[model samples]
Target: MPAPFTADTVTVHSPATSANLGPGYDSFGLALSRYDRVRARVRSAGLNVRVSGAGADELALDEAHLVVRAMRAAFDRIGAQPPGLELDCHNDIPHGRGMGSSAAAIVSGIELARSLSDDGRARLSDAEALALATELEGHPDNVAACLLGGLSISWLADGRGAAARAATAEQLAATGIRPVLFIPAEQSATRAARALLPEQVPHADAAFNAGRAGLLVLALTSRPDLLLTATEDRLHQGYRAAAMPASAALITALRSRGMAAVISGAGSSVLALALADQAGAAAELTPVGWECARLEVSSGARTSGA
Candidate 1:
């Protein structure tokens, strides 16, 4: 049997996602137009991972590389040894700006593995693909939006742990929600951001965030006009503001500017008002030193590589 990867290299383009929609935290996410185009070609020589575009030249190309690790994980799942392959990544998303670079790499690797699997083609079902990606990315927020495409709302099942570090094998099978998200440039390590918390929060603030997270879903499916009121937050945003004070500040600015902006996921990015009427003009906010893009709420969050 010929190796699937041994054939002409397969290529894929994955979109990035913004998570935690202001107050929704972990549960809300939206897909964007930005992408990382991945081309995988099995080579007769040793494994070679080539990166191009955006921050490609600045990336590391070794075994511990995220792309390589993800590809290896996919092959291992199918009980097959990965063939040496040349991977070229046109990275359009910033490395650690809270976009979905990690998600794109994981999705690209999973797609490569599926493209090179035993049945000569062991593609993953959308749900299966989402599950595996969530496992690698450590949460469904970015993976679900990247794999499924669009604004999605996903949460741990009845009493599951935090979405960031939760064992998402089963949790990935859960449902998703929609949101308006933003990404800012004021960045920090997720762990470091998480470390700033005082461990306990006033029950009032906790309740405030919980109620808004719930409203985030309703604002999308039920009444979008209510989002201004629904997407408000108290817990994650306030705590993270210590590290990303600019995130909250910017959201306020956008709101005053008539844009419904919110902090994206953990920090450093902002998800601003995006809808049919506002989507086009939204890109104008490409502030100096900030890469702004017009993101949409789609169902399958994917784009053509070309």
Candidate 2:
């Protein structure tokens, strides 16, 4: 699909993300430099989707599209009559690669809905946006990182989920660690990867991951040296290894070399937290078919022409 530049467009640039950054599991997420662009304009009374880039051929072009669903979800939340929308999506985030491509779409749509409401109200508040996105996303980590930027830590208490952002780009700059992603051609569905986890784990293993999650936060914020031990996980990755053997093997190999490596989100993409000076070090270890990129932690989502 062709993307035409126009003065009437409201556009958003949302970053792709690596979630579950090591031991934090569903509670952790990190935004990467790569992004997906969404351009939206108010239409009369229908939906139109024009997609270019990853999954363009396979993704829906109408109401069933993830972006459209998100917009509807947002409109319902605000008690606003939904407006017609025309969406031009340029998706770069790899699908099913544990990179939060879906989260990007969800955030883009919610923002689009906010940008197009007829009431001419102030833009959706951050809290409203987070709540709407979380309702559609089923968790807060990835969507929070995509919506709020930087690194996000989410948890559930009293059957309600709450998320907070940390490790902003400025903080990461001070920490002296770089994010290196190893992306494989093969895709592993998040649902399938999640299914591999057992219903129960050893009490010791659960305690181990809890301790590591705390250390991982420290490593991400002020203590880069602790990253080697901090990224270790005893929860989901090992159990999901069979779903993406290549990713599992590559993570193991990277860690063996003293790099702090772990599955990016679920599987199929590996993130190695490398020292800033050694950012390029993980590239040499990439296997034959996988791709590697060094990414900075993004600040947050941005919208123009809103």
Candidate 3:
């Protein structure tokens, strides 16, 4: 039997995320302070969606909307689809700028659906929620961070998504590191950026990345001083640099000044893991047209009004 929804309305806030932080490749992720908020209400009859901020002009307001699609998937798992839905999305995350905008939308939808059902939480454990989100997003990194928050390391176990937070909320606060993003006005598609990589990398490069990835975890948690060295990569960044030259140049410039910077996710936006003292300088290095923001490491998604 389908689980009946216990609530008429639910709201969820999902944070933006950056994945593949330096050498961690498809494993590392960090949630940012910015977020997208979605409020969904069960209705008696059809679908209604309203959008504002960021992708307001481009996003669909129908069943084709990513959030709606995610809700549909979750409802299917719960064995009941609402007769109708009303969704209002207020977004802060920029679309296609290498921030996990899509992941935020997907997570928000799933969380909202869970919040609406009487037994949704029981039916969808945290692991099950992560697995479903990963199936929808096609990777675990960004979605993991969006769900679990702070710094998360995610991987597949038996072909299902699994993740753990590397630092507690308190531990992350004590690190005194801020995430500074340099976002270009232009956008880069994840697919297009991915197409630039060679199918095979040299064994030497692979070995080099493994060592740095290990060091990166240590640096992010307890040793901010090692970040400049720890964030070095021999994997994806260099190969995709040509497609986002400005981002590539900015990262190089920031690193030369002793800051740890990398391409955020696929391309276009650059992320600098900056200590309190370095945050301002990191922002100053942003190119004329790019947007810069200094953000704290964020907590995971939250739902209310179920």
| lDDT tens digits, residue span 1-306, model 3 | 134875467889999899998999989999999999999888777999999999999999999999999999998987788888889999999999999999999999899888887788888888999999999999999999999999999999988989999985558769888899988999899999888889999999999999999999899899989999999998999999988888888998999999999999997899999999999988888899899989888898989887
Q: Which prediction has the highest TM-score against the true structure? A: 3
Higher-TM-score candidate of 1 and 2: 2
RMSD to truth, every model: 5.7, 3.7, 1.5
Q: Tens digits of per-residue lDDT for model 1 on 42-125?
A: 666677777877666667787776777888877776667654667777887776677777888888787776775645334555
Regions more than 4 Å wrong, model 3: 1-3
Candidate order, TM-score descending:
3, 2, 1
- CA-lDDT, candidates in order: 0.65, 0.83, 0.91
Off by over 4 Å in 1: 4-6, 120-128, 156-187, 275-287, 298-306
* Per-prediction TM-score to the true structure, in the order listed: 0.81, 0.93, 0.98
* TM-score computed on alpha carbons, candidate 3: 0.98
